[model samples]
Target: MKCEDFLFLNNQVCVIVGAANPRSIGYATAELFAHYGAQIAILDVAVTDTTQAALRTAMSAKVGREVDLLCIPCNIVDPVACDRAMQMVVEHFGQIDSLINCAGIVRSEGMLDIPSQDLALMLDVNLKGTFHTCQSALAFFTKQQKGTIVNLASVAAQRGGGLVGGAHYAASKGGVVSLTKSIAREFGPQGIRANVICPSMTETGMLDGNVTEEQFNQVVAGIPLRRAGKPLDIANACLFLASDLAAYITGHTLDVNGGGHIH
Candidate 1:
């Protein structure tokens, strides 16, 4: 009936990956989820005592309250670490209602310029890493018989390698799209929902060395919205897909690209 009633996540435990950076989509999602009354657990390879403290301080300042937060050190490429991280979240929070995977890496080199190791690393983190985290969370979700998953992909996956990423990055994200769809179909009957969000040219640290000022302005001009996407823009989509507001929506690729890549 009310706005909050539709999007509220009161007491829900949500695990968000790649949230250590304050300016990242993951952080914005954490802030918004906290605003909606969800308990947050962050997993990042860069998580440390200092980063965790800084994230807590930043989130508290943004949310205007002492947010319920947990930070775990996890490199999603390692399946063992992913499993351990999920177990820790459950041990601390008692349950995991949702898992939002925002962790990934991007490279801007041309296909031929991308070396063997670079391509391998790209797929390992972007594709295989996402798979690891999803499998880890689904282990618990399958047992609980109900859960939701929101995966952050890139518009590069849909429109090819014209954005900030290279062909390898686009290919990896395309894999992510296919992976989410398969999970949605396989696990939907078990009451688990999986969806992907493809955001275009978001204002996050990921664009720092990837896009030049001139290129950014040119890309924004082509976008119907005539502006770059903010982290909150993508985070809002994550909230909807991760909340009961999208109870019946699964295996869907919701584009938050400001009409940049209209099919």
Candidate 2:
């Protein structure tokens, strides 16, 4: 199939977890999906007054057309909240065709310095939060016998964090990778596909929060592409995984690290 044939997501209801900020991968994925004609449901910790407005303006500009958008307030650490949020998406959009888990935290504290509370926070938000959201969305996918899940892991998980995040962060994301594969294995028989995207150094708020320019530049030197990843780079991959182009693919990990981490 041609590229254009594989790109459109018209009328599909897609739920993007953690689309609260403009620079986040979640928002970027939503924007790209909207551009491809998907009806978007955005869930975040709290949908601010500016949330809908910002999404409308940005997505409209992105696709050069008005987008169908829904905003929901959710805290994914709570399984009930995750379920309730998706329930609202189902009620509004009728059926959910895709779920993209982009909600996570980036921590750069030293391994020995990571406090118990901080470690718990990282695990709860990055690992358990993903678990809750996936579990909540699974019922719908299983009932429909057709669904796609695109989860966000990190290169830190693969390489054990010489880049930005700490050891604890890497561990949590490692868990995400394993969990994604488990979902794929368990649900593949039911026509549900699950995959993980592991990006190395992306130009997102998560990267900014953890790395300085010098650190980023140093890492960039080692990458074959000689540049940091853009949000669109990762968003485009998410688009493909959610589309029928990836129908035969599941439990796979796609790295968008500008060739930073080679298998």
TM-score top scorer: 1
Q: Tens digit of lDDT per residue, candidate 1, span 1-263?
A: 77767447988999999999999999999999998889999999999999999999988898888997999999999999999999999999999999999998999999889999999999999999999999999999999999999998889899887668999999999999999999999999999999999999999999998899999999999999999999999999999999988999999999998899999
Residue 42 lDDT (model 1): 99
Q: Which parts of model 1 are misplaced by more than 4 Å?
A: 1-7
**lDDT score for residue 47 of model 2:** 78
Q: Count of backbone clashes for each model?
A: 0, 0
Residue 170, model 1: lDDT of 97
TM-score, cand. 2 vs. native: 0.96
Tell me the lDDT of candidate 1. 0.94
Model 2 segments more than 4 A misplaced: 1-7
Q: Each prediction's Cα lDDT score?
A: 0.94, 0.90
